[model samples]
Target chain A: MNGDDRWDDDARAAYQLPIEGEEQARDRAILRLRRESAKRRTGMGAWWVDPDGLRMRPALAAVCVLAVLVIGAWSGAGWMASRGVRAPRPSIATLPSGSTAVTFVFRAPGATRVSLVGDFNGWDPEATPLARATTGEIWIAQVPLEHGLHAYAFVIDGRDWAPDPSAPLAPVATFGRRNSLLVVGEDQAL
Target chain B: MRRLLALALASSLLAPGRASGDESEEARLRARLKPELATPVIEVVRSAAAQGLPTAPLVARALEGASRQAGDEAILEAVRGYAAGLAAARRALGSTARAAELDAGAGALMAGVPEDSLASLKRARPSGSLVIPLVVLSDFVARGVPVANASNAVLAATRAGAADPALLRMRERIDERILRGEAPTGASREGLRELLMKTPGTPKERGSREPRERRQP
Candidate 1:
């Protein structure tokens, strides 16, 4: 009984030492692999190529903000155009020499063309063509006018005569149609 | 030969200097008008200019006719009528009247307002520009206000010390009232009443409110 028991114990001990050494070697190899993987993740290889690495640099942030604003403005203008809203009131800026810069805005949604025909422009429809705005319904023309009374009308598509709905009607209907009246006072908007 | 030379010298002496503005205006007329129609129209404009009246209205009238596809005769008549109106306006508004006043005055006259009303307006607003009062007067007439009623309303407003803004406001109110289905005359009368009430220093008593002539400067 003593001999058999002693031999079994010695054999078990001899096997346990190699097993423990193998496990230690395996653990060290595993740790080396983990450290190499971590180095690759944080290294220059990932820094330049990874999108997350760009995280809000000033140039990129500014570009993003500008892109958002441009998209917003474009959409807003398109919405305004679809609604057929009237353009804003005519703007008048007085020059240093007391001359007036009169911005004439007309809303003609479906018209292909619009022109300003007035006494100041010799009543020639082609003399002052109004430009269509991005809003699509409005046509605008700027005129430098002297300080006096001006009689004007809008010619639409070169055939239809339209008076300014915003201005006073002229007292006389010389051509069997009433024109609009504008009186430019000193430093005054139409 | 001596007689011919003398006649040529006399002709040269008598010819008026053609201003660059006049040339440009003539060129515009020619360019805008047909060949046969241009000559008579130019003569009318020149005559009006020679008389110290504003020729722009005359030229504008001709061009308006052309733009409207009016007949040549109609165009000529329009220009001549406008020129006559300008002359009448000058006489009524006096030589001191500015180009704007004359233009407005001409428009008022063409709208069936009596020349005397223009004269009265000049007297009422002697120091101020009469453009607004005249334009408002013309607008009232155009809106179907009887010429006399429009004249009286504007005259009263002017004599009540209403400035251009006040007069414009009165016009806007009248227009709104007319748009709301009120009779033009009643609208004008009520509009005038509202203005008089709002006017500073205007007597509240119906009897105390003097006639326009009595209040004139």
Candidate 2:
């Protein structure tokens, strides 16, 4: 046995040597690699569309719920606008105790004067006057009113009594003239 | 010493701080109205205030009359009548009724709704605010629905647990129907039917009650 022949024999023995479960170990390694590859593919791409069905992490679920709520609210607001329903402006602000500052707006073009008269101001036309906007016919006034129901009307030019077109009409036409009704607080009747 | 005590009493009575709400309200009336008119109106308001009824509405009524250029007699009559209405409303709505509720109830009473109907309404919604229901009832009457029909509709709706927004929506729908040429009574009935149908937990049969035709106003 020369050195070449001995080397050849040692190589063959090394290649053929198997202690136990060699085939099973090789098969398990192959299976693990396949699973790892599958996991890598699924985890990196759109896991939402996984054939196994929908599954989501906690963060993802929260985001999806938030998106749904925002979209629903947006669509509802659009629907309301389309129906000519104007959301009441958040114009009422807390002022001094027992009173809230409420903004009243009316449009009167070519008017010399406009005044707000209601139970809050003793129905005196001179109590709270609305200022005219420079660009348009809009007249605006912020009046501090006690929390309750009030009957009011606009005095255009200080003589013509006009009920607020946006507000509910009072039931009785006192003095044969209709007045508008306003509810100042959370318990608004109309 | 007697003279000094008399002077002290006079000064105290004349002090601005000593002027009570009733006196100030009288001052406002006197300022805005003729002295002759203010005296009687103030009496009515003071009497009402003493009876635990709201006086603001009475004073407001008188002032509104004056602002509208109404006659002194008309103003006096309006104030007296309003005070009477407030008393009646307080009776019907119970003593615990809020001021806004009383005001709305008085309007409903003045709109031809019977006192018993007002009582029935308070009975129907014992815990909730009756302002919207009472206002709606008055609105219906003002729009030409017979008082009986209006009262029945509102009572039924309130008893059925219709919220304020629902009642207001019903009012808008009825107003639209009236503007479209439907009789007020018919519009109100149909509006109530629609409301009952939509209100949660409302019985099915309650919305299908027989309708009575009322004379068109």
Candidate 3:
């Protein structure tokens, strides 16, 4: 805009590159461009190496992206290799030593389905399905009951309830149904 | 808003014959309560049951209320509050979460753990049942462990493929350390960090150090 301002701007630009200073880089780029221009009369100078030409080559950009992909892939492979995934075991429920092995038995004459529902399985109806005897009217499942008081009952035909006949006398109001009470770790577990 | 949306979703998704089963359950529940206390408590259970919220905690609330000799209105309000809490817990823990997980997770929420942190813990252990972890986590916080620190400890153990037994062991160790006069925050922070780092593939978890992660302070 003004002569003094132009001079100040140029001076400021001189110190843009602190290590080598902008002036030195500018001088080197100009020298290289002039040498190339002199060697060939008109159009021999390449775009990448000229004083005001493109600062980075398309090749460099490709290389950078490739390097990033390579590093990312390498790390991802290592992560996959290190992750240990084990299948959920169907039996031998393990939690604490004090936990008791409780055998839940129920008799349903015409029922096609029976599951042992309780506090131990988060009351998940599907988590602990009972195994029915081939020729009998009984269903049974042995589950590891955690150490503490648990309320449970048998769910029959999905929505129907059939209380365990052998459950203790104490009946509790649970899920609007009577749940059998069993305290694990009593008598040091069974 | 969340409650209304959930209720609408659940009601719309219900099978035609569901109400009969629900009606019987409700009737049985009412039969169990005193006449003066039956209406409100049953209403709360019906609302929660309609939304597919776990209904056991509601009944347990009534039983607890009766044990405490609380007013009928108080029992209803308590059931309603717990139902809402369970809904929030299920939302955070995901739809596939088991009833026990929801029960324990609700306890965690009541103990002051944030819903998003519970979500993170669930996401971290995509396969394990989080019920025991959540129960132990809530217990730790109740016993004076800072909420964040307790959450972090649970998350770490779950990520390490620790199950109910391992979690119980970790809880015992942490509680013992706390009883020895060490601060809960410090004990959980360092103890969980070390345990997680030793978990085969989880060594990389040591460095994230996200300030928002449920941990000390």
User: What does candidate 1's lDDT look like per residue over B1-217, in tens digits?
Assistant: 9999999998777664457668877998899899999999999988988998888778788888988899999999988988888889999999999988888998899888889888988888888889889888988998899888899899989988888888888998998798889999889888888888888988765323544543332
Over A118-171, each residue of candidate 3 has an lDDT whose tens digit, in order, gives 656645567799888663566768887665545566778777754454332122
* Superposed model 3: Cα runs more than 4 Å off: A1-190, B1-28, B202-217
Model 2, which residues run further than 4 Å from truth?
A1-88, B1-19, B211-217
Where is model 2 chain B poorest over a 10-residue stretch in terms of lDDT? B208-217
What C-alpha lDDT do the candidate models reach, one value each?
Answer: 0.82, 0.81, 0.65
**What lDDT score is found at residue B76 in candidate 3?**
75
User: In candidate 3, what fraction of native interface contacts survive?
Assistant: 0.00
CA RMSD of each candidate after superposition: 13.5, 10.5, 24.5
- Runs in model 1 with CA error above 4 Å? A1-90, B1-18, B206-217
Candidate 2 lDDT by residue in tens digits, A1-190: 8999999999999988985898899999999999976775677555566665456799999999999999999787555433322123467676669677777777676788999898888888999998886635667788777778888888999999887665666778879887877676745424
DockQ of each: 0.45, 0.39, 0.01
Candidate 3, Cα interface RMSD: 10.6
